[model samples]
Target chain A: MMGAPLLEVRNLESFYGPIMAIRGVSLSVEEGQIVTVLGANGAGKSTLLKTISGIMDPEKGSVSFDGAEIQGEEPHRIVSRGIVHVPEGREVFPLLSVDENLSLGAYTRKDRSAIERDREMVFEYFPILAERRHQEAGTLSGGQQQMLAIGRGLMLRPRIMLLDEPSLGLSPLLVQEIFAILGRLNREEGVTMMLVEQNARIALELAHVGYVMEIGRIVMNGDADRLMQSEDIKAFYLGQQEAGQRSEKRWKRKKTWR
Target chain B: MDGVQLLVSGLANGCVYGLIALGFVLIYKATEAVNFAQGDFMMLGAFVTLGLTNAEYLHLPFWIAAPLAILIMAFFGYLLDLLILRHLFGQSQTAVVILTIALGFVIRFVAGVIWGHEPQTLESPLAFGDVSLGGVVLGMADVAVIVVTVLLTWSLYQFFQRTKLGLAMQAASQNQMAAYFMGIPVKRVQGLIWGLSGATAAVAGILFASKGAIDPNAGLLGIKAFAAAVIGGFGSLPGALAGGLIVGVIEPFAARYLAAGYSQIAPYALLLAVLVFRPHGLFSQVRTKKV
Candidate 1:
């Protein structure tokens, strides 16, 4: 990467009331690149994204965005600086209409014309959102809600988006459709993204770089293709197994990366 | 003719109660803290208008004094949240309830010191007039009160339904965390809500003062308004007004038709009945908070 990366987190540590969630986590995402963090449940993937987005204050570490430190700033302040966090569980305002949710995405922007254009662009990206623009967001299906969450993020015209989990609770085909759109968004709009996901296969396919987290620590970091090819990743995360090996024994075996 | 006369007067009083209930609902919706001082805020609003329009004071005209009082009260509400209530964040909701109760006491004492214990009549252009429709007669003051309440309610509805800031306020009230993520400045929005609530209370106070005599103790009427809020379903705005009307209409009829002094307990009796039969109130908008 040339020049400074778009977002850099160094030695980041956050806590959930004395229980450290992410410790000494160091990572960087270059401009316009999709960086995916893959982990099992309780791997602190969500915590890392929350910390970067200023939803959770870090006890120790620095989060620099475009050469400016933003740690400990309020979430809204961080958002105004162009980092939008699409929180886990698609936390769209349940009572609000889809159009209202989208309007709120651009809440910090003052350029009315640009906002109107962005609104049209979001509708183009997720046509279902346009159709249900007047319907309450709570009525949406899980897949549609996830799409609304992403489309809402796009309304910010954000420099970087920290997506906790886009593919969560979606069907296999729906995940493919969402990931394809994400890939297009990155390529066409140049929106830098740091995505955290439990679904490793599809996340790896679209990501330029991948980091594997376990027990609140990063154990592996490499190019996406290389991580996909790693025998350890294949056996543990990808559900591949050696011939004649029982699943119980595979679970009992210690992870090679650790 | 007698019945129509009673209805008009009852409706005017009900509008006052509804406006006060609105103040309660606005603050409750935003912060989930019931301002026990809401009635006292109304008392203070009336006192402020008196100080502005009284012959011995600034002596401003009623039209000028009322809006100025509302504006001043609105700013006071904003500052109250910014300086005091803002610190109460993360504390238990019970703490806020207790603090606001104490605030009510302090407000009453301060009002007593400023305006004295004597009841005062607010001067108004409509104070001396009456309009007769066939055999039924309506006081101009009562008519004005009903008109102003309707206009205010309609404008408030338009604001919450149409404006971006209004939608943002609704968003913040619904989910503070999600609102902040959207860069809506949730704290500031909360302060604005407080201001709006204060302005609403001032309008209620002015209406109450116009139709009747006001003193520091006049704020005690807020108890009836609180009952009205409960009867309407505490969460819904229109419900608050309807609840107020229910309480207001019940009083005169109970007094005239029932035994002597029964009017004093009618609103509370209705409140108890609603609590037993429909605990969530008439137009309950209560939804379980999304986890």
Candidate 2:
């Protein structure tokens, strides 16, 4: 919260054809903080990210970043301005090699030496991508492709990273490891991030601030640890499963494969 | 003139089809929509060259004049992308396909109004003398057709692989939305791909005109280029050239043995046969979309 908030969404509303996905939504991200938007399926989390990134346009509200208004800017222009979105479903170019995918992420940059340096940093984060740099991404396992997807997003050296359900298809072990990396990246580099995820427990544990959405509106917002203690959250989200028992259920899910 | 002489000429004609087909392959790889007006692109190129040569405004040789006309053709391609084709982005496959078809008709009609339907001969670098190789005769013009095509294809290959812009084009063609997220100028990439396709078409037109017949509806033979694309797999560049060669080489043999009837359908027949077995194409990446 030093200079200014990194991103601010004020009264944002977006539509899909005739259906209103979100109505009168507002949020804010501090310059160097991890903000998590937690909600169940169809709660408009992905739509919010898409609208801010310019993949979709909102009929109302404003998306301002670092004091510059960027509501209607094209997605390509938005990326060059350093807001990188790692979309859901790991849409890596299936025919391209891992190295090529990473290089393409830096398409608008002119500093060749820095791009090379960043490439090494990305490989350090995801060693599997480095190991399979020459292999086509489509051939990689789902978890590996997900890593590559994140790695591709990192190539732009983005100031604010928007991730949608990063742990969706990952194993429990991998999920824990990925969240740890997100936490470390935020702490060490101060790269602001917005994570929209279904894993409420982990999202709440890692995020400094949390916002809960139901039926396309923020029903609750507070400190992550404090939100976890809210009776409504505990009753609606945590009531379905015991708190510590998620680990056991996750184990059972993993054991089926084993 | 003997059987060998006829074969050489036939192969040379086949090279022309391959050249135009490369344009088809180029645009298709970057945008899955077929520019039905592709043959028209070639026709436009040749027509431009003809107009330039007729005007003698630059007072340059064919070498200089040919490249200049191609540059103009590239501009037309860019304009086409900006004006009509760009709107088709992210649209349904069938809608884009039909849009291109309509655009092709517009280009054809414009060319007919400008350049009348009389055939004219271009200045051939080849002298009238023909060399007989083992009883096979090849005029220098015929050799020029094959040589020009090979050289053009080699240059295009280098353009696609070694250059940064070319690699970006490849990435954009594969998944444009992801490309946009990757910081690529997706709109510029689309415009440039159309420019490349137009330039390639122009070169093919000039080479064919050098051999014989420069007319307005000269785009008629552009149908063969479509066959080349289909035979080669619409998405594969090398496959298109190979498909062009296959169609080119087969027709003469078809004419010689199959009573001249099957010769015309050689490329289309080859396309149908390939589609029946390898629907993705001979060299295209095979993929399955989730239902």
Candidate 3:
């Protein structure tokens, strides 16, 4: 709150061919804070994360990481600068062994002993990964693959982690398990995170600040607790229906702020 | 004694085929683009070595020329990808196949212009030497071929299994997007793979030249090597070598025991039989890409 945020994106615009996927969106993640971006499908939450992580270049505006302009840099270079993007669908190398996948996360680092130690640390975080260290990652169940993906990200020792839908396709129980570790990572390691999720309830509970996006734009932003109490969020996201309010009419009702 | 002699010669010949097949598999594994011109790359490597060692040219020793030739071919492969193949990304696989096929024609024509069409022998320390073991005799050139192939395959296996860069290459080959996310320079790693393949092709060409004679058309032998890769399972490294050995050993036996023309058709017949029975290959490890 006192100085520049660890990662700041200002008036960013990105296009998929002729269509704009993220239009003039701006957000910031302060060092050591867990920020969550909640949005429905097609709201461009993943696009925003991809742009910031340098996987997709922004057509306009700037991304500054630790006060340095990093727009248009290669994704690998962005990772070396201490930002790691855990892409959606848990894109773990399916053919590689779990250990090989973890070692690759430290590809940018040259410290031999530290890399070995961090590999151990990742195993500690996801003990299941250690038991299946020699197994091909593709053979793991969806939940375990997600754990391996997060463990792979931690191997980078990243200052800021951009995680896209860590809970996607996961059962409610597995989601709780993963989010708990994420909260611990934020608190214990001070690893700043910008998580994009559709499950608003759990995301808000873990995040310090939350942003609500709709159709490539940030429609609302506030403290997580206050946003959790907002009537609109309760009505639409938290599945709380007002008395006599039809489910079909919910989409037709305009937000108070708009 | 005759059978032992035939087997040794067949194995040495097969080793060359295996090395060229390794080039094919390495490039295919990395980029998913089949370099039909891989044989042409071998041809170029031989010509380059010839230019450096032949009396009318640089006239350098074979020992010096071979390594220099390998380095030059590696650099050429790297540049070819950087300048041309890199631009073809996102294009259809068929387009790449056609382009490489055309590239093969270009390489052969250019090589013909430089080295001419006549068969030429490569001078080497192993040319006339022979080692006799019991009742059978082996040409030093043949022994050298088998030894180099074994050593090269072992080192390549160690590299992919143990080295960081090698692991990174494997990771990139599996999933480019994930590899990029891991801070791997995927494009650069791909270029390095091409360079490695080129170097491998040079070794094949040098060994082939050492055994007998090389003409511009000698590269057509890559077709046999391609058959070997398919038999081995295009995705498996050792399979390629094993496939090569099968093809190499079959040809001589077919010539001696069967008809004269049967030797030429033996490898393709085996290729057909493998395709019919085990379409994925003898040691297939290929998996459909995860969405």
The order by descending TM-score is 3, 1, 2
Measured over the true interface residues after superposition, the C-alpha RMSD of each candidate is 2.4, 2.3, 1.8
The weakest ten consecutive residues by lDDT in model 3 chain B span: B282-291
- Which tens-of-lDDT digit does each residue in B36-55 have in candidate 3? 99998998898899889989
- Winner on TM-score (2 vs 3): 3
lDDT of 1 by residue, B1-291 (tens): 888888889999999999999999999989999998999999999899989998988999888999999999999999999999999998999999999999999999999998899999888665678998886789988998999999999999999988889999988987777788888888899999999999999998888888988999888889999999999999889999999998888887888888887778989999999999999999887654333
TM-score of each: 0.95, 0.91, 0.95
Q: What's the ranking of the predictions by DockQ, best on top?
A: 3, 1, 2
Chain A: TM-score in each model:
0.96, 0.91, 0.96
Model 2: per-residue lDDT, tens digit, A1-258? 677688999999999778899887899999788999998999999999999899899999999998999998989889989999998878788788999888887887889999999899888878889999999888888788888888889889898999999888788998898888888778876778999988898888889999988667887788998989875566556554445644445324321111
The C-alpha stretches of model 3 lying farther than 4 A from their native spots are A244-252, A255-258, B288-291
* Number of the top-ranking candidate, with TM-score as the measure: 3
Q: How many residue pairs clash (N, CA or C atoms closer than 3 angstroms) in each of the candidate models, in the order given?
A: 0, 0, 0
**DockQ, cand. 2:** 0.47
Better of 1 and 2 by TM-score: 1
Tens digit of per-residue lDDT, candidate 2, span B106-137: 87788777776677666545425676677676
Provide the TM-score of chain B versus the true chain B for each model in turn: 0.97, 0.90, 0.97
What lDDT score belongs to each candidate, Candidate 1 first?
0.90, 0.82, 0.90
lDDT of 1 by residue, A1-258 (tens): 699999999999999777898988999999999999999999999989888777789999999999999999988899999999998888888788999899989989999999999999989889999999999887888888898889989999999998888888788999999999999999989889999999999999999999999878999999999999887888788877756545546777677866
Q: Which stretches of candidate 1 lie above 4 Å from their native place?
A: A244-248, B286-291
